[model samples]
Target: MIRELYRQYKDRWLLELTFDRLLRWNRWWPQHRDTGGLLCWGSDKVPPDEAAHTWQGAAYESGLDNSPMFDGVPFNTKTNQLQLADVGLTSLYIADCNALAELAQVLNRPAQAAELRQRAGTYGQALQMLWSEEKGIFLNRRTDTGQFSDRLSPTLFYPLLAGVATPIQARRMVDEHLLNPAEFWGEWVLPAVARTDSAFTDQNYWRGRIWAPLNFLVYLGLRNYDLPDARKQLVDKSNQLLLKNWRASRHVPENFHVSGVGRLPSEALNRSDSFYHWGALMGFMSLLEQDKAVELKKTTD
Candidate 1:
């Protein structure tokens, strides 16, 4: 169903939001563009406000609500309506473009496939401008200043998932950053913020918590780069955390505390839903493992 929809709309205005996000080329952007990256319903005069209620438009888009990464970054505020172009959104858009290209190929639409692939590659090129050599991580660039955001979130690793990072970059990110105990790695693994960052706080949603989707994305990137062992380690840790939480609370929480691994802190403010489907990503794990098996079989064959 999704593939058919993609086939239908891939050529149309489906890329309008993506274009606005990647380049902000649209001078006359729609009101939905102002709503924290969410596609909301409304007119040019007034639209549903996501960021007005809380300063979490971009964070919400990343599924990490209240991540400090968006701190001080005005997005969809009453006083200001800023369109954020973060590395995560750009990379994800690139990935989506590539996926749609594959669907086009399956339908024997070579021209459409080539066009989508080229578009994806172009977006990937644009995404590279966000790389910060000093930080050794990709940061979000404000469309306003075209300057990178100082806040480093787990979304930094998303370039790898987009297949935009070079082999050397991926190695450095996975080795020096993602796997570093003082950075994202801990008991549960892959906190939202680097442990060395002052903003990092265990149990804080998106501040330092472990999220299944975040790890799953990194896992996909690791596999894409043929780092099977690292991918396995991530999958193992993620599964362990989920199982631990399930055993303790008899359900999975939206995000798990880095300090406690599987347990949510009772005293922690701004608690999340104890059970959310997006965080589960159960089928994602199965699909990844299955892909791994297929790869292994192909190699042996």
Candidate 2:
């Protein structure tokens, strides 16, 4: 389906690459900083990767984390700390870990290869430093401040998505944090930033709105951690939100409000389309089937 979608929108994607990725006038490098990966889109924002940080060149496009691509072969951990000269410096710390883990899983599964080991180290640091045991969620860090964002965004599932979190941690996040009535539980899987959060402002930070791509990541992370029931609920919520937007606007919005308030069409054609946020709104069939599978397992058990 993803392949088919890509093919269907090949023309538009080429344009996105041109307008969003490339520089004009026969420039070899893209105008957007090549963090060796993709940059997070903020509302009128250029992530640190392009401006304050540097990219060495290897980027994970699927991730929303801040990573800098570097020219060196393998980053020598002992000799290296983050430097402004490197691209991919800033990342949604957890998202990058999950992306790396999946890459490791695909290439190394349960192996303890060198690359996997390095990734594991990162995973360890992420969980240890970034996870809020009290909140049962992961938080994004501004790095410069050394404090976690008080607003709870869905970026915490990086470890769960990456399969780095233990089953216990996954279950806690699912049962407590993500599903808690006071926390993230939503008609959909909750907004990128819960409106209830003090920092949530509709026009600020990343448009002060929910984002489909990040929603997609959180959903996958939960699923990866084997939180089947929570995953089902989230998938169902995603569809409901998508349909709600479609019903209201005759098309999907890039994101909706946690309280189901803003169902209007996305302001621009950026990344809110179903085709683009393919991760957030699960196709109805897939979500239903998975829910059925989980139900069947529960019944048998």
Candidate 3:
């Protein structure tokens, strides 16, 4: 988002204003959430009476409230961290370090840029260790038993966004997982969980519902690779989902049905917010693809 803001507005002042704060946030993850060098979703020590301040607080920190990924996962009361080395959080932190490094260079802070780059590399290597060659995707590891969580979500695709996946690994992930009809790909592009997963039938928030932000983030990850077909399919389907709901009741939903069943916002179940602004990201994907097409045409012409 900072990159897009700078691209459109060239606002150095805004970047400068957020750089130090972002740096602190980047550091905070490793400091507070680090579990053997890989980060987990966690909270600082809070009063016991604080609502959602325990395991639920860690889930909230993941921005994936009630995702099945956190289901039954243990929390370390001693550390205030989930007992899982989250692939999503680790990949995102690597991406964050890379983005902060770019911003540091843009702001003429060479030392900070170098530091951020080094951090990215360290975390990137650690994230790569999460990959399951047998599963053809990265899985979250239980910090307690050192077992990989079989529960899969779009968050697993984030390694591509972090630029940590090799091209061959990316291809395998896209082919074996992302495009699998029984999993993510279908009438709807990407569901929060694999369709075959038991949680998918729940059709609940972050369980089986389709989220625009998840689609958008996965789309960005696709852009990092040579997967043009997957990328186009995602953009087209996301646009269709947005337009279908928008034309029906002028609603942009926080999420959509995996089966493409829901239309009206009022019809949304499982606390899916109707008319949420981030839902517009579904349409934004199309707009970005359109821009890319136009740029390609110009170059060809």
Candidate 4:
């Protein structure tokens, strides 16, 4: 399956574009870990397959609010040198770095481990300071308005779930942001940003939708951090949400509302671009594996 997926994706346009998005850093690029370290941040609201949304991936594009430049970090693939591109939202680095760290640990790659550690440090510093406690979320550090995005999003969970924060950091973060009954436990936690935060709206797909991949990140992040009970609860709840949706709509929708209502299926192309879209399946199966979650339907709503 791995070999087939590689063969299937290797020379496609998406892969071409994906490869083009690698780090453009001048001297700080790694020579060993480039394959995993993204040279650019992903678009804000668009799924990987769409090009019309934030348009912020790998190129020095015509539009983008490049920011939060991470300096002097040193994880890279052997094929590539230092990777330097526009640093994206805090969540991006945390999730990727944590995954990198795990891959390093599992593969017994010491150099990659060192690089992942340094990158995690930079990401942690950013998350701790960047979060506006009053708002209970991390805002995009764009140059515009000099104001925060004014939303509590799934992005915040990435840092904690990705193994970027220490235990103290995780506990504080979970208490303050996630595990809070008032917020995180909602019908599945409203989509990315909270509805009460002046940023919530039904049409704002990402801002309020309950995305599977993001939830998966939370489950995996908590599991990686050794919060067994917390991880179990989240995994269980997330699975409940998925099964609920699967039952209602025979087919698994890309995402759901905080209300647990499935959204209309997207009409985007490259439906087969697993990495680019339909990442929700990955989340569902992940939780299912851990919690013995069930699939209630095969036909999507």
Task: Choose 1 or 2, whichever is better by TM-score.
Answer: 1
Ranking by TM-score: 3, 1, 4, 2
Output the TM-score of candidate 1: 0.76
Off by over 4 Å in 2: 1-113, 141-148, 201-208, 259-301
lDDT of 3: 0.88
Question: How accurate locally is residue 70 in candidate 4, as Cα lDDT from 0 to 100?
Answer: 17
Candidate 2 lDDT at 181 equals 63
TM-score: which is higher, 1 or 3?
3
Deviation (Å) of 54 in candidate 1? 8.3
Model 3: CA > 4 A from native: 47-49, 261-270
lDDT of 4 by residue, 208-254 (tens): 55667667666656765756667666666766766676567554556
lDDT per residue as tens, model 1, 1-301: 2443555666534443343343332212222442333221112222476453444544554565667766666554442333456777667766776776676565566876787787677768777777777777777766555567776666789888889998888887787788888887767777887787777864567777777788877777776795766777788777777777777777767777776544445554345667878667733675669776998899999
Measured on C-alpha atoms, candidate 1 has an lDDT of 0.65
What is the lDDT ranking, best to worst?
A: 3, 1, 4, 2
The lDDT leader among the candidates is 3
Which segments of candidate 4 are over 4 A away from where they belong? Answer: 1-88, 98-116, 131-149, 264-301
Which candidate, 1 or 2, would have the higher lDDT against the true structure?
1
